[model samples]
Target: MYYFFLDDKMLPVPPPKMEVKVNNKNKTVNLINEGEINIIKSPGLTEVSFEVMMPNEFYPFALYDNGVSNFITRLSGQQPTITYAKNYIDGFEKLKTGNNPFRLIIARFNQKFEYLSDTNMLVTLEEYNVGESSEYGFDWQVPMRFKQYRPYATKELEITTNENGEQVARVKQTRPTTKEVPKAYKVAANMTLWEACRRASGGSLDWKAVAELNGIRDNNVLKGTVLNLK
Candidate 1:
């Protein structure tokens, strides 16, 4: 048999290669389609993510040609990069103040819905009646663009140095005094325990707790007993 120059079968086969061209001006990534669409939307998902580029190790032909020919370069790293600038969001600075309001805008095609809340947390619920065709579905998978007022919670605080000369941080929890109590010595005459408790503690101190604390029973007040106001 004629001898071959070298065992060609012993040589390693070349692997496929790919190149990427990123357009920073448009914030778009272009890559060869391997049956994977870059755009994704899911109703059952809470978070969304996608790979803009693969690692150099995963590239089979990356080492070929001494790792220089047909090499991939990140667009951001390229000189004279093409980058686009977008306007800052409106009311972002104003939202930092407590006066800013919350807005929830949802759009499905042309349909739109918006909700406003003064608080940071929001609760939404939907229900379907058992007899009404039993059709109910929820999709929390969509990405939400939230514009929050800066400083969700704030209070005017006064701080003083401790004995060790260390600064101390204090938080105050204050809500509107919704309920009013009877002023000192304003306990209604011939009132029941419930009535007295209602008046004495601004209707805030639990009636049961008040009764237990002051030895009152039910709605009945002790007759002819002087109330000791502390």
Candidate 2:
């Protein structure tokens, strides 16, 4: 069994008695002989679709009333309503202001009707359809589609000063630190000091530093000459 809770008040409606489908959109890449690789992309939104039955008691007059009053009231006012249709319509309108998305709680049950996993989803309504009456009552099937709304997580960095008055990077989280190691490179024909330093230092060290360290007064050096890079 699954349950969906709309806005803050938990609304008085019971959980839908239908299957809820969840879809996750992800990016994938295919490499020959390597199968498909899932790329680390942004926290993509999710799409959910389900059917809901709204009883007559829970239905608001605004949904069935045929007039421009409902539209004007919902569009130019902040008043709250108990009607499910008005709540959803108002909630969607509020999404344009960049406010917090609506909350959807999904509760699952096992064969014994025991509690299973309870997942909380923050989403915005994307689409909805009102089905035709198949039974003889006010109850109607409302198909709803929602999209997940979540911002991407970003890495935070901390900058601090060391005892020697030198600035150092102090990460708040555990991360891999890259250490530059000294290397040796042989000068090749038609290669300048800048080019040699760039190749030996991985394009990080300056050419002046390399020339000074090697005691090379002339920028031009003979081929086959080896220089120490630190």
Candidate 3:
């Protein structure tokens, strides 16, 4: 048996096919007095793509982890209608909107369901395809792409006293002490600073404080702007 999970949430039905692409960052060049040689560089992000099945009807082969949520439409105090397809779609939407990296785990097992090995990594959901298909009947097929996530530091200027007792400032980079958010956030188009902070912190961060720290008078920031969270 095998299990697939994104951010600890198990997929309802295992995809019929799963493909993982380990990207290459190597460069080929001609060196001085040498023929064409490969400039072997570090590996690129590992990409995983697969089409997950969402069963509209319950089948013995289908697995359900906890319950599905109706995230898109909900009146004031009403709960969402639980459906397998909607649950998976809700998870995907959260991943795309959260702007965070989560752990993806693929576990292997024997017929008895004993643990074997696991393919585990930190990944960010890149994109996903959603539409109705005749082949799916009343069910749904969602194709998703996830890329390995590597963290980076946020650059900031630090003031320090030199040996001559003179105050000096220097640029430094460091990760965020708080675990809830990233070291820095890259602003996307039509992205508000408030929304970014809210998503990054999982509602744990105060947007006003974050904006004050970044000296952002405008909540509507430009695209590609790196917001320092330190």
Candidate 4:
């Protein structure tokens, strides 16, 4: 079984297919005396697209918040179709007006109801097309597109007087000061005191001696902190 969710709310019907593609942000550069070469960069925004059908009538296979009972759907003072459609509409409104990107999750399961792997990402809705189908008569065909969202801040340039008394423009970094990794074994999320010593001394130095050399009392450490190998 397959299920799609927007912001953790499951969609009533899964789209027949969803397309995911990555935008290429690499650059082609020509070096001196060297032919053209590709400079690989971080990936660009990802795109997700699919077409879904919103039935006007409740089909037996339709799922309403994991409940397929038509009786339960009618008790909510709306048709099963309206129930599902309104949910999607609400999601669209949030995507259009919300300040932050919402989570998109796709879950799959085996026929025996065993849990399978899932994919989750933060995305911003790019576009959606709502069309009425004459053949389906009152059913809605919605084509939706979403793009991966990543937040960033732009640096501003400042006009400053140089040592020679000449005015020059300098880019001032506005983000919080970040520690520079001067060596190979800078403490990080994945690098601990023990791990750093192993790499710094290559298993030749003991942990206690390395910790004492770096003045790391009681093994207290934090990310971006440096451990001295000598």
Candidate 5:
């Protein structure tokens, strides 16, 4: 038996059948002489397709009163739902906008109904399908699809600094900064004050200082204007 939960609340009706697909994308180069060359392989997206069944007995009171069609409307609406499973180990929060990514855990069940191997995935809901429905005592079928969502992790670097004349390794979040100070630079086409400072200083200069130095009231900088970088 498969169990589904939305956040802490388990879905009243669990779909009878659920399909999970893992996709991998690879880059190939084709030449006239050579047949093909594999350049790189990308961590592809994972998709979960399932049909939701809404029965009058299992549906919420609101849905049952308003009609089973409301169930499809709710799923198709902008609201997000965090889904997980009881027997299956994997779960994820469905989001409507932005980087709607979440960790997913899938657990295997044996003949005795005990969960065995577990697989974790990071994914997002890509799209969904609302198929034909039957109104025989209020029964509906809704299909959904989920894709993979991956975000780059930030890395920290430790630097040895002299604190109180003692060398110590300090760890800090690294951001782009300028190092070398330039005397002046002509504002190029499509150049912003922020970009100018970044180019003048290796990576340690701030854009605010540049703006203050140039007396720039607005962010827009005219092209071919030479500004002092001191």
Candidate 6:
């Protein structure tokens, strides 16, 4: 069985002999651990925890951060756009099908900021008229400061297998589904902003108008389902 754990210092540790089930058939597999494996559990941890699980051998992976919905509330002016990435086995294109196992990891992060202002000009008065004086002028400056906060998440994934092992090198993916806003059948979730924009422009959804209506800058969604882009 493959056991993962962390030390008191919160460093990830992957133990040998992890238990894995292939096509619903249980078995123990050995890890060809590349660099390091660290896992740890802290006391009284309610909100977050670190984890590392190897779904298969000989696969290099990366993480993807799905933007949070409430992230827009933290900033004053606008919401940030969400970025996506594809996780593929290192040099996957060169490998032959059925000779490689497609292993990947996904994660999410948020932007952090620090407020800095050197001038109180925002609160100071600007003389629209040279002869007229005012106590204050309408001025505000909100610059986006950014950092990354890797948050904790748990993902429930369905594993697909090849009974004949004929297409082992091919990437397995899920079927697409349409997304709607709270059962209203408005916004589609599973697509990128670009895709969503195109679909919403068709009149069934007002893709361009929603931003002005909500006073929201970005289109990052927090819905539980992924939107299927048609």
Identify the candidate with maximal TM-score.
Answer: 3
lDDT of 3 by residue, 1-230 (tens): 66677874668677878899999999999888998999899999999999888877766566555322222112223333334687778888999899989978776667654447668788999999886889879898888999999987667899999999999999986646655678888865334455466446644566668888989875445546788887
Query: What global local distance difference test value does model 4 have?
Result: 0.66
* Model 2 CA deviation exceeding 4 Å by range: 11-45, 58-98, 108-114, 130-140, 153-157, 171-230
Q: What is the lDDT of candidate 3?
A: 0.71
lDDT of each: 0.29, 0.55, 0.71, 0.66, 0.51, 0.26
Candidate 5 lDDT over residue span 165-211, tens digit each: 76676557656543557788886533345445544663356566777
Model number with the top lDDT:
3
lDDT of 2 by residue, 1-230 (tens): 44345533232344345444545356799999999999765454567767765544423323221111233335544232334445544544565344566666564556654447655677877766665575826554667777777754567789899999999886577555433746777866323455455445544576667788999875445457798876
What's the TM-score of each model vs. the native?
0.20, 0.43, 0.62, 0.58, 0.45, 0.17
Task: State the lDDT at 66 in candidate 1.
Answer: 15
Stretches of model 6 off by over 4 angstroms after superposition: 1-183, 186-194, 197-206, 224-230
RMSD in Å for all candidates: 33.2, 29.1, 14.4, 16.0, 22.7, 24.8
In model 3, state the lDDT of residue 108.
67
Please give, for residues 1-230, the per-residue lDDT of candidate 1 as tens digits: 01000000100112122122222222334568755335533322122111111121224322121111122223223222111111111122333233434322111111121112111111111111111111212101111122222234567676878999998877776775454544333443343343354345533444456556666554344334444333
The TM-score of candidate 1 is 0.20
Residue-level lDDT of model 4, residues 7-116, one tens digit each, is: 63556678999999999999999999998999999999999999887666667666655323345445544455335575677677787678778877776667764447
Lowest summed lDDT across 10 adjacent residues in model 4 is found at 189-198
lDDT (Cα) of model 5:
0.51
